[model samples]
Target: MLSPRAGAPPPSCPRAHSTYALAQLHAALAKSGLSTGSATPATAAAAARACARLGHLRAGRAVHGASAKLALLPASALLPNALLHMYASCPGDHYHLQLARLLFDTMPARDAASYNILLTALAVGGHVDEALELFEDMEDAGMAPNEVTVVAVLAACADVGDMDLGRKVHSYAKRQGYCGNVLVCNAAIDMYVKCGCVDAARAVFDGMGDRTTVVTRSSMICGHAMHGEGDKALELFAAMRRQGVRPNGVTFVGLLHACSHMGLVDEGRAFFESMEKDHGIAPAIEHYGCMVDLLSRAGRLHEALEFINGMPMEPNSIVWGALLGGARLHRNVEVGEEAIQRLAVLDPGNDGYYVVLSNIYADAGRWEDVARVRRGMKLRGVKKTRGWSTVSVDGTVHEFTAGDCAHPQATAICDTLDGLLDEARRRGYVPDTSVVLLDMDDAEKERVLARHSEKLAVAFGLMTTPPGTTLRVMKNLRVCRDCHAVMKLISEIAGREIVVRDRNRFHCFKNGVCSCRDYW
Candidate 1:
């Protein structure tokens, strides 16, 4: 019998013809073996997009392997761009930058989207310099930077306080009409704010032709609050609300932080409640932190502890730290002990908790307990972190460690510290030596308490900064009670504002009054 023609189908319904065609196509692909091995560029691109959508790394890698086998993956600009996005969106994957960089270097045709992706990855990854470098490279390559590029570059500038670079980027953005983009404008505003250039930040905020987003408003509020401008922050918040922009979680965080900084306990509480009531925003852990800070500042230690215990979610180290701090502020040894215990269990390897516990015990005159805790610490091999401070003066950043005598101005710093102590004593600054937990004589304890990092930073601030200018110091640890008292005296006697940013919160001293109200 004569064989049927190649295109002819078996004696079946006409609808079966389509299925026959599909089978032939599959057979052809299987004969080529390309489908089973490496994926073609078209297939890789599609797979990359699908992997990104599903967030399936294993499948993505398999597709990538297939592409590599065919040499059809990431060889083209569009395909690599898609792959770059896939890598960038993977959480905790820092190698995205390397991939992005490689793809960016090898791409024969670069687009604004690719450049923006790489720049954003760099900025968010804390590689500000690399972001700037990429921006410069993009400009050199004659690729007109788009709105996304402007925002990414501005964010990088903001992170490092590169005002010169920021100004350049701002000018470029304004020229490119990117200044109208809310995201670009917000990044500009945030950059200025974080760079300690509040005036610049305000200028950008005011010049915004469009309405600000909640994130932009929150950034402005937080910038003002952090720089000791609570009233300004509140004003911005009010303006944001009046403009019909709903405040988000970050907005509430900024508002509550502003109130906490200014010791506005009632206002802070109202904002905290309104987060859920008026704004319909659930309070996050940071919000709870703000509340704990507020109550602690107000000397409502019992209330703060209760609030922490009543949290809807499991408390983290931050909450426990705040609770421990509040206990120390109120001298509630029992609460402090409880917080310390919980903290130890929560973070077994953290040495700060142990040190704070010892300090609390020492503050409460529980010498035996302090000794026992110290013994336990030694047995567990828990070593306390050494305190350090960084002071920037005259374009030089000076670092000091606890009991450090390595600075070129060490002698002057020590003498100035002695003078400050004498002046403080004259002004009724009694040293609370109880913070030193070592089993030593009273004189030795006094000496140990005298050399705390906060004291060192304050002394350096007094000796260096102008007579009436505010002293801004940052410490890596909490300020001891004795040092806190001395700072209050120094602020009054020297007739200057003293701002200390410790590990916990900002402590402002003016005229013998700390912004914490002796609560923290």
Candidate 2:
């Protein structure tokens, strides 16, 4: 057992190159008695920070155990908070997150820094609602939030498209004099964009004035690209260049995405070629994925295949999935089969690739192949991911699944949807029953399509909000063809703007036309 001693110097934390470096640090600490009773609160805190930065979980836990045995908790709160921060900093580790939470709960005293660390961990770990709740508790307990708190909450808002809460937080940050804070401003910009409010994001970007960095510019370009405003994205990039702001790898990714979504084939190829030559940025996997998407979406499946085969690195799921997505869109059975063959090796359990391939076969009238795919999925126990959509009314987010009837206003929502569908049908809106992959009759298929998650969310929005209020719907998967058409009809018939953010991109429907212009 270690005995209490005076103090030891903090371990040196050079820029860690590998786990071997971390192991060396651990060994030095132990050899110098820094990991024993000689560890002071200051030394422990510094060591914890180093571990956090280097993502050395094992070393951090050892520090924690040593601190506990030395009765470090009673000496200073700083050490405990540092330990909490260390655990919270490790991403994709649920055990560390729980340890952080437990440390926070058991801490005798807490501060804003403590709260911020846990809040960030919760938001990044996909426990968004819990993060929001913790923020509320922090406010209730009079723990005034710092800039980090605002950023974490904004991240949660973006994740669920909680625009109402996001706006409230934005307003609070503005009043709290955080407007000049670049990090908070960037988070707000991202939140607005994710919530399908591109104008709001642009406003934030413009408000930054001279303070806008490469990150700010990149967010705006990506936002516009996501909203299918490819011209605006390209225009911004040109302006950025004129201003002498060199684009980074992220900026090129957004630019390439804009080109892909807008069907600018030659422009995309040029940007891909210029990335390394002009910008000195090597083509990363994401950039390669964007290029494949550009080619595939433009019905150049063969070219996309050749590009994938020639990739410097082995093609990952994203590259192959891009080709598969294009195959599904263009109904190229041959390319779809090729992509699936690759994806099966890379990610066989991904139900999405299987479903897409099945749909491609169904579209080609190859019923036997479709049946074979279904049988394989059943044998593999791979379940299709159910589609869902969420609409925020007031400050609450309401979620709906396909044929969902769980909401409190389910009856009224269904009645409203029926009326809207009837009106749309009268206005030349025919349900594309071919999108329904199930072996049901035409009428049944139409019924199924009518009750899609986005339609339900739209109906709920119409019933709950004022007539002119723009409805924002967030979907978990790609919007089907039938739902996309219905959105257009509803926007025109109801005389309201509808914004739907699906898995791929945003669709803004207004006056019987979509921003994507049927290209997406």
Candidate 3:
């Protein structure tokens, strides 16, 4: 599939000098008029706006300082809003966010634009919880949110997979008539997709009908692809083409991702070749990585390795990661070793790669090698990433780590898990202890497996939800083989549809069968 080529660095903005000069003139005018204190808020606001537009943080700070010296900031909300906008507009460093927060909190009176500026900044800065809190405060203040506010809050909800908040914001958008706005609709689509509610995302996409953009279609396609609905993804692409909507690099990436997940090798190859020939889009590193993932996932390790060797550009960590994942899947120790060697150089401090290699060795029953890899990780000071899972019940989000007992409902969850495992065993469910990776007895391994983060989340779901309610859980790591097997058994035993979004993709279990068909 087509990938984005890294274009040359953008030419320096020629108007930067002009913009700075304009800001300087505004500052000079404001300072000259400061003697009489003739309401220089407008002048200072103009200077700040100019600097914000050009992303001149230093100049913006200077303007702020000059305005403060002239005592122009408290005259009106304009100058402070302009200063907040400048800090939010600047792209680098935490200093901008800190300063923005300080200014926002200290503002004598705030407006909707003021709240929107800091909310967008906090969300974009990855302070999602803080952003959501600010949004709540905005609501408490009787502020009617606009499209930007809705979009920003929806985005923050998506980052944390806060489906309850996301759904509320979606309703709010509809009530506020923001649903007609394309940007708002796109953000809604993205939030639903990321939250693993592909059906909800599709509903939004279909409603957008004539308003669909490349981003909207691409989001839906990738959503379907990631949910393992490859056929639907392809059908959507076909419809896109029929409707004369030109696909971009991201669309092809989703197409390739669909192919990779579904093992559609020939179709994937055709798409990859057509990316450059028909679409006139050069194959970027992401496209190459997708191709490698496709080939490697389909048990074509030799071909994948050959393809990597012949790449026009140097293969990156993602390219190697694809091969490594394939090798781990197919138990190709040699290929896995090779990929890890390259990965060691490319990303020495990453724990996931080392863990993957260690798992590969463990799968082959190479205990000494596994121990060696573990030692190497210790020497390099790389700690394995802790895995966790979150499940939302009745609008409350509950989090759990492996063997976690911190929740107030821990006793009930454990009891529920015990009962499920007992019933699962009666239904011919045998724990697959190979995934433990630790040198322990089968009994110990089984106990460890039973206490996995996903199991705890699933047990909690069982305890809290009504019968037949679909259990949706989000995990920070891939689900282990034993858990996958157990989930299928539990689905049949409890007559529940279980949906899990793991690090890799979504797994929907119903009637003792996973949507992935045990492939992932």
Candidate 4:
């Protein structure tokens, strides 16, 4: 809650003493006779800046308590702003924003810099709603926002996925001539992309002038690649290079992602090699994961395994997970065994990967191995996440979890789901019982799979939306194999395009084919 003031006073900055404050905090803290009473605002500000930069919360709080005891913050805007920033930059697990907000509320008078620092802290510190609330309060206090303010507010909007408000902020920036600011423009593009409107991001990117930098190129490329627009991402890369801008590691990460999504295995490898050879960028683990995923999804499991073994660094869980996923798809037991063995050593007791391995075993008719996996899970006390789906209708999201028939329309939704399942079975749609990993026949597993969250959500979608409407679903977990098989049939039977966005990526089921080509 912000209290309004008629106006705020000017900033009272202390003498700039420590330009090298961050690199020298340890030295200062190790000095003799640095008592709190004798400490000036400059010394405290520099120390707090060091603590904030280095993420030293306990030391920072020690300084904060001293400032409060010395009664220095109420007299100077600069000291209070430093404290506000210090608290805000404290780790989120510590809930630092609460203290930041307290400092903000008790400030004697807040200038634009005070508000700006607090705004940025809240936004980056995971207090998105509070940041927006403070922004509104700043405007209500008759303070016109500068570019910094708009960018911070826009980031908060993006974090909360408020595209409507983000657009309004963009409009305000344009009206204030702050849209031309390169950093602001980049934030706007990032905001749109994060809000699931790559088109809007493209609009912002195309509207930019000569101030675009490498960051701008990476953002645009990532936006296009994220939306399954591989060609567009590559085109942007070419344009970026044509303008004499060197691509960084992130640019190739996006490029590799685009190639992986589109199944351009050759191009993916080429871009990967080009990154190190031409761009002088060594591959990070994420880039290696992309290449592994690229090879695995294209049914090159042997080559993918070789690539993993030949890596310069030890493969992490993500890299092994890619191979495990490919093994699941191809039911190559040997590769799955190798990847799982490595993953078990690296990231032991990870339930998701273990489940995938169990599913692979069941698919290959290795019931003994599946039983061993179940025993391992029981020993490790790891349980699979219950799948959940969220369907938004009329601006309200209705959530349903597997085996949770708790909603008002649960009975009707289940009944409709039953009908759909019966029709699909009659049309030769077999259930993927391998995904269940239960000690039962396919028929028994089919009964269990019917109750997965996505089915109930699809049934609800059919009941609520009119005929021929595209049903969009967002699932909290990965879409299981049975649910995916059912979704493919539902799209054909219902004569509607169904889009299900899961944890990994989007699955657009149209005319019996998923956009991912069933790789995921």
Clashes of each: 1, 0, 0, 0
Instruction: Note each model's CA RMSD in angstroms.
Output: 9.3, 4.3, 5.6, 7.4
Model 3, span 199-298: residue lDDT tens: 9999999999799999899988998998889899999999988999888999999999999999999999999999889888998999999999999999
Residue pairs with backbone overlap in model 1 = 39-66
Q: Which model is ahead, 1 or 2, in terms of TM-score?
A: 2
Estimate the TM-score of every prediction. 0.68, 0.88, 0.93, 0.76
Identify the candidate with maximal TM-score.
3
Candidate 4 residue spans exceeding 4 A from truth: 1-80, 91-95, 104-119, 126-177, 209-211, 391-398, 412-430, 441-444, 455-472, 485-499, 509-513
Best by lDDT: 2
lDDT of 1 by residue, 266-341 (tens): 9999999888889889999999988887787667888888898899998888888777776776677887888888
Sorted on TM-score, best first, the list reads 3, 2, 4, 1
**Cα lDDT of model 4 by residue, 1-520, tens digit:** 1111112211221122343643355554433113536666666776677666655555566777776777767777877787777776642533577777877898888887778877877776677878888887887887777887788888888666566667778998999999879989999998877665677799889888677889998988987776677799999999988888999988988998889888999999999999879989999999999999899888899999899889999899999999998888788889999999998888886888888888888888888999899789888888876778877565456789987779999899999999998898888888877787778877788888999988888889999988987776778678887898899998888998887767776677888887666555
True-structure Cα RMSD, model 3: 5.6
Ranking by lDDT: 2, 3, 4, 1
Candidate 4 clash figure, as a count:
0
Q: Give me the runs in candidate 2 sitting further than 4 Å from their true place.
A: 3-79
By summed lDDT, the worst window of 10 consecutive residues in model 3 runs over: 1-10
lDDT of 3: 0.86
Q: What lDDT is obtained when candidate 1 is compared to the true structure?
A: 0.73
Candidate 2 structure, TM-score to reference: 0.88
